[model samples]
Target: MPNMLLGAFPIGTKSGANNSTSNNKNGKCKFLLLCGGYILFLILGAAMFSAIEAPKIDAISKRVQSFRKQFLQSNACLNDEDLEEFLKAVITANDRGISPLRNATNEMNWSFGQAFFFSSTVITTIGYGRVTPLSQTGKIFCIIYAAIGIPLTLVLLSAMVERLLVPARWLLGTFNSKLGHLYQPFNIRLLHLSAIVFIVITLFFAIPTAVFAYIEPTWGALDAFYYCFISLTTIGLGDYIPGDGVSVDNRSMYKIFISGYLICGLIAMMFMLTIFYDIPQLNLGQLFTESTNGETEKLHLSSNNTTCYSGPSGLYMPQRDEDTRRAIVRIRPHGDDSPSPDEAPSSLNSGIRVP
Candidate 1:
């Protein structure tokens, strides 16, 4: 009788297990259906948005093409008299402070250096208006080229700034040590940064601004300041340009000077950013977001614990997360195969697996 009861227990447990499995399967199906519905809704919304925006984009494109056609029409290649008239119109526009609608062109075969400078100016958003890309192919290429070139310029600027900060970091430490007793670390660092800013402004900003204001036939202090602000911000509106201020014999020298100004001003800005980072409060911009906060904590841990922290005094390293490491291991099975570099060993598993 006892053996029969034991057999009945197995049947009872099997029934319970099957019921639980059916319940779980139903739950999963419901969840999957809900997820699929949400995704479909999102896709529909995006399609609607694109459909609405399409006409506006098409209209703008059509207008641009129409203007391009007018500009590139063979009549645009004017004789000397016509050219003179055109230039005078441009100059007159400058004098009267009236900007005519710009048209496209269909002329290529510019000097390599000219093309390079033009590309740089456009990518930097400076649009100096000294030279512009001509030709339908050139304009199309210009759009694509600027897309890539601007990002490249940003990366180059970032790298240059990183390199420049080496000295700035040392200077910060020196100042901190000197003023440790008298001021907080943040205050001392700010003082050090101010000194650097004073030097940079004296040479790069104030001096250049004054000189440009005095020489530029039409530029006042406000115009000069605006130019400085615009250029430094990389707005490159091509409206208020530097060379337009003066009629110099040596255009090459003027361009070289402007290039130097750009480089120095960028370096100064990076120095200011270094000081900004020294303040723990403002520096939190990188770590303030929910996603980045996790990244920040990981960085803090790694920097505090590892040799990466000791490389330089002011080099900021982030903390690492064991939770993320474990999550990766859970997703990938580690039964027989070696784990990937990113995957951590689970506590339940004994062997140290390598990928």
Candidate 2:
């Protein structure tokens, strides 16, 4: 037998101290580069976002300023400072989904349906920041509620992901059977993931996009698709919401259904992520982490006349050369004539040497 194990083993201490030190240095360098790259990525995202969004922010600021000036002009008695304070309060209220104007026709934000939507979003970590607790009591309750509910939501979603994985694995198996000989396993797995992606996009994204675009007055195709992606990814930008318009019929039902859609869509998103993470080669964590020693201390003993039996390794076991019948051996004390089925065999004759 060889002194080392091979075939897909981790980094072992087979090399010298110099090689280990070099590998440690390389790992440190890789880690530092990863940190630098991540910071650069963040900066890049910030720069691009500023470039793309600054114009819209300026336009909104201008519109709000114009509205403020117009309001002051119409209400001649109200001074600029007074209107500013009033507008601040109105903005605060609006931030919490409380409309200051009397033109509102929808149900109150705390109504059962809206509250249900808020709770679901909160637990799922998809908080849109659109509706929020105004009172200290409600805020405290929200903290407590989230503390208890988030884990429950994760447990529920994780169960769904696990159940979904069975079918996903089965699909991968089917793909392997059909194309295993023609393509590599990685390629076949990619094809399986692609098929699942297509199905998820069709059912959760494409169909919902069409439905939402049809029903939502302001949403175009791009907006609907964008909303689905953002919400399912738990981004929850709060820029747009379905079934929020005053003209929406049966708005409560709509909100409830939208909440359900968000939950289901989130599950589908998690399922895809699970599939992606299942592919070890695609995992990025391995790039950032270093392996420890994986070698085991092995001892082997052999003698010419002694029989030997090697134990099992995984599914592979040493085959038996001969079969031994399983027969019960019973022993009792010499003075005991009655049958003693519970007596151990060692009581009659001590251990026997095989060699």
TM agreement with the true structure for every prediction: 0.51, 0.75
User: Model 1 Cα RMSD, Å?
Assistant: 15.7
lDDT of 1: 0.61
- What C-alpha lDDT values do all the predictions have? 0.61, 0.74
lDDT per residue, candidate 1, 1-355, as tens digits? 1111010112244654575566556656666766798899999999998999999999999997786567557566755567558878977654432345343112221534335446657766667664565469978998999899878877877888787788877887788777888998767867877887787778767888898898677889888878887777667666676553334334444555676677567657766776677677667543424333433554665455431221223223323444323222133333545444544456335344221
Task: Give the distance in Å from residue 205's predicted Cα in candidate 2 to where it truly belongs.
Answer: 1.4
Cα lDDT of model 2 by residue, 1-355, tens digit: 2112121222333443456577667777888899899999999999999999999999999998999889889999999888779879999877766677676655778888889889989999989888988899999999999999999989999999999999999999999999999999999888988888998999899999999999998899999999998899999998888867656787777889999999999899889988887787787777656422211111121122212222233111112322110111223334444433433464334321121
The number of clashing residue pairs in each candidate reads: 14, 0
